[model samples]
Target chain A: AQSVTQLDSQVPVFEEAPVELRCNYSSSVSVYLFWYVQYPNQGLQLLLKYLSGSTLVESINGFEAEFNKSQTSFHLRKPSVHISDTAEYFCAVTISGGYNKLIFGAGTRLAVHP
Target chain B: GAGVSQSPSNKVTEKGKDVELRCDPISGHTALYWYRQSLGQGLEFLIYFQGNSAPDKSGLPSDRFSAERTGGSVSTLTIQRTQQEDSAVYLCASSLLAANPLTNEQFFGPGTRLTVL
Candidate 1:
């Protein structure tokens, strides 16, 4: 079983400012981690994923997340955010095996203000 | 050049009525999933389908929720005796394979918004 917790419900940041969205997970077995972004009136779009081999993962949109095993965290970060980045972000986890199920966090609303 | 697609983009129905939402996954994808998103909330897992075998239905909230996939392609999610609480955006997703436990990336549909009045 896997559970994801997103530490913040809302984050307000000025355009071009650095930001981080914290996510933690509890799982007895190995898990895969993912970040998804949802724009207004749209469904979720995959941002990045941490599968294996590398502790750090990045998306083409200038966002990245590092998977820390000891810390049990997969926090998303961006060196500079844009107004277009204002959206709801969710962190999800899924255990390895048959009948894999995804557990998602409540989500963090990123408000990028110019 | 197609992605996951869902139908009845918006629906409004009276209480106690039943509704059916549809999903058409990407070509050749074998794994499909159903999820619900309420106002100001994240994705809620509902069900999972893999090939023609039995589905994983552990996440369904109640007996009123049921889903079926036909010919290993399209799917339909049915909600019975709809209640106000059932009003939400129903999302459908599919993966090339059952999310490789190591790295699962599920492609999502635009979603169907249901409103029970």
Candidate 2:
């Protein structure tokens, strides 16, 4: 079985400050990693994904994550965050060749203050 | 194009009662999925349906939980004899199920929040 673990339940940072949300996974087989963001009262939207090729994947919103196979981790990072960046982030994983059912971690709430 | 949509954004039902949550996936999407979000469980996959193939019920918590996708577009998650533990947000997502799994992005609905009294 595959599982995801978000080290932090909540992260508080000031606007314009850098932030990193830690995520680690345990899987017996190769897996694909993803980050999904959920704004308050909104549905979750895909942030970015690491499927193949480069180990580092980035989203349009200046957020990036690197897949570290040795560490079994995919941590999301933002150089500088905005007030609007406050949302819940989830780390998900699925077997590379298996069906599309996603195994998600307990989300991390990002609270960006002014 | 419109995204995934779910009905009865908020539902309040008594314990031991039954409830049905509906999901309308994006048109032409061949794959649909049901997930539950709660304080205890976070987000968990409950069921999955792909095209005309047999649905996957491996993620269901118990026999009281069931789901069906008709015509490969609309899906309904039925919870019979609901309990307080069943009070959670039911989320539905759909994907195109492309030949490349990397391209198959799942779009989520606003979700139906169910409260059991």
Against the true structure, whose TM-score is highest?
Answer: 2
TM-score of each: 0.96, 0.98
Per-residue C-alpha lDDT of model 1 across residues A23-96, encoded as one tens digit per residue: 99999998888999999888899999988888999999999999999999999999999999999999998877
Q: Tens-digit lDDT track for model 2 on B56-91?
A: 789899999988888878888899999999999999
Against the reference, the lDDT scores of all candidates come to: 0.90, 0.93
Worst lDDT run of 10 residues, candidate 2 chain B, spans B48-57
Worst 10-residue lDDT window, candidate 2 chain A = A93-102
lDDT of 1 at A45: 95
lDDT agreement of model 1 with the native: 0.90
The TM-score of predicted model 2 comes to 0.98
> Share of real contacts kept by model 1?
0.65
Q: Over the stretch B36-89, how does candidate 1's per-residue lDDT look in tens digits?
A: 988755678999999755468988889999899999999999999999999999
Q: Whose lDDT is greatest here?
A: 2
Candidate 2: stretches off by over 4 Å: none
